[model samples]
Target: MGTAGLKALLHRVRYEVLPAKSTEDKVLAHVPRDVVVTVTASPVKGLEPTLDLTARLAAHGYRVVPHVPARLLRDDRHLKEVAGRLREAGVDDVFVPAGDADPPAGGFEGALPVLRRLSELGSPFARVGVTGYPESHPLIHDDVTIQAMWDKRAYATYIVSNLCFDPRVLGEWLARIRRRDVALPVHVGVAGPVQRTKLLAMATRIGVGESTRFLAKHPAWFARFAAPGGYAPERLLTRTQEALTAPSAGVAGLHVFTFNQIAETERWRRALLDRLGG
Candidate 1:
């Protein structure tokens, strides 16, 4: 494939950063102001930390989007408060997920319900994102995930696929979405260059049970770590080049899971951009 398409997509790349300690410096010093920064929420720490980071990034003049896990929210009033705060923080975008919380924190049962509530309350965000599982979820059936995305189509501006190693699987899933005429543009979620250990740790933190199932299902993905240096997200992106550039695919851009390894991720991105003539 020509570098033109890859170059174009690369220019639109965004970063997803978790709220690890001193992540602010990691992002601000490494990631450029032109890139859209998406802050991720943690079930352990809840929503505030991610929102706080999003606000900090926005104040520094970057386009900021934060993930709002439905399970972390307290109530309708809490949702309204969060919306207001997000707007105040200059956040124009948000990504909602069902989350890995043990039990319901409040009324929101899932991302779909949260989307509905946001719409009902006059959504403050311009671009609201919903998750897509290109690979089957560990617990939820593939059919349910597809239906969830279809239902969320009414509210979501776009879909962000979770980190999946297999490009072929992602392509097929994207095609399936297109077949259903669920036209939400997809932002491919691929991990940036981070230690294999950190990636596994992240997986466990997100959901140990799901992580085990996920690793088991994609053994090839896990096996790669045994012999190599850290996983290179570029390889996955390159392998999915056709899917990414296909007009019918509606592959908007990339949503890189940086995992707070900002310096390395940014370096890799810039290097690729240089090679691709970005």
Candidate 2:
């Protein structure tokens, strides 16, 4: 990709944040309003924190998206209330996830059910997103995950892939998605620039089994960050340039897993923007 293309991809990058205390304020206070901030849900607690953070962020005039975990919603009334609250807050988008709850707290089993129910309820959300895995999930078969995404395509407006370290795998998997006629605009997830120790800790806290698989998928990357140094988000971004800019990839842009390291990630992105001089 050329400088202009790369700039376009980086300029409007989306940042995903957790529902931790003071995290929303820190992000809103420091990061540019241009960056779209998405809030994540915690299975242990439920969707309360996510929605609370979303409403606050929206009130602050920031473009915010909250993760709506299906397992956390108790029933249709719950879903309706959630939708109403978000809509009243001027929130237009939401990302639905199957969730990591041990056992669902409600009738909804997974993202598919929630998506269907939302559509049936005449949901107020303008854009709905679902997850995609570039690598195999530790708990589910790779084929099954792909097919699940395809089945959910009718209800989803876009796809946000989980974090993956290997560029080759990300490229090949996305290319395959394009070939299969699953042409949803994909916001590929990549870890933001963060120190190795904190990065791994955050990865564990997020419970992305793929994070461990990422290291196994590329020992060299693991080795580089295993010691005292930091991991550069650019290393991964530079490697997968083709998958991002290629038309066949149907790539939308970045969905950075900042892991609440908003300042660090924003610095990296700003430097890159200056370097590109656009």
Candidate 3:
């Protein structure tokens, strides 16, 4: 498929942001008007700011999908309040993740619990997204992750994959998901063109080592990003593009991990699409 075909296939585009000093305004200013804008719930920033950011984006006429970390929600009441706030702001769609919290927050220990509660509430959202780790999760086992998705399928509308460097692994994972009958439309995650020094600095700041299991699975990527060539997301995207176009695969769109490098990412996206005549 060409660029136009690919563009036409995209239902939404997400831009993730931490609850930084000027993150909300910066993301709002840079994100395209036509696509959805998602605010990430980071361990450092917490949940309140993500909700506020999502509301702000919704006000700006973008469909906002906020990440609702399971541990951040204190209880069912808290979940209700969060859902209410999104509804009031005309925001729909959410990404539920178990989160990086050290301990469980009350009754909700993971995303499955939160998703179950959301289903019980009968919210107005047209979609609810769940995470899919194409690469190994830092802490969870592959079997456990697959089971989580199977359980979440009843509540989630789609799957947004975690960043993975290898296209073959991603494709194989997609096939596995299909075989398992967890056929939610997938949004393949890829990092946008990011500065090497900046990427490492941010990764270190975020304590990437905290997830040793994840590090163990992708030692090569860690080494590559740490080395001279650093991380270039295009090479991965190019490899995955054909897989994305495959007949049996239900790859929905690309979710660029801008890492706050929105301008560079957007430029790269446009240039590539133009080259493909999209």
What TM-score, to 2 decimals, does candidate 3 have?
Answer: 0.89
Which of candidates 2 and 3 reaches a greater lDDT?
A: 2
Give the per-residue Cα lDDT of candidate 3 at 160: 88
Clashing pairs in 2: none
The candidate that achieves the highest TM-score relative to the unseen native structure: 1
Model 1 TM-score (2 dp): 0.91
Model 2 Cα lDDT, one tens digit per residue, 142-249: 888888889999999999998777789998899877767887899989878867776567545543322343454555655666666445678778778877788778
Better of 1 and 3 by lDDT: 1
lDDT (Cα atoms) of all candidates against the true structure: 0.81, 0.81, 0.73
User: After superposition on all CA atoms, how large is the RMSD of candidate 3?
Assistant: 3.0
The candidate with the higher TM-score, 1 or 2, is: 1
| Cα misplacement distance, residue 150 of candidate 2 (Å) | 1.2
Clashes of each: 0, 0, 3
Question: How close to the true structure is residue 97 of candidate 2, measured as C-alpha lDDT?
Answer: 86
lDDT for each residue of candidate 3 in 46-130, tens digit (9 for 90 to 100): 6877888778778878887888888878888889998999899997788888876667656677888888878778755789998
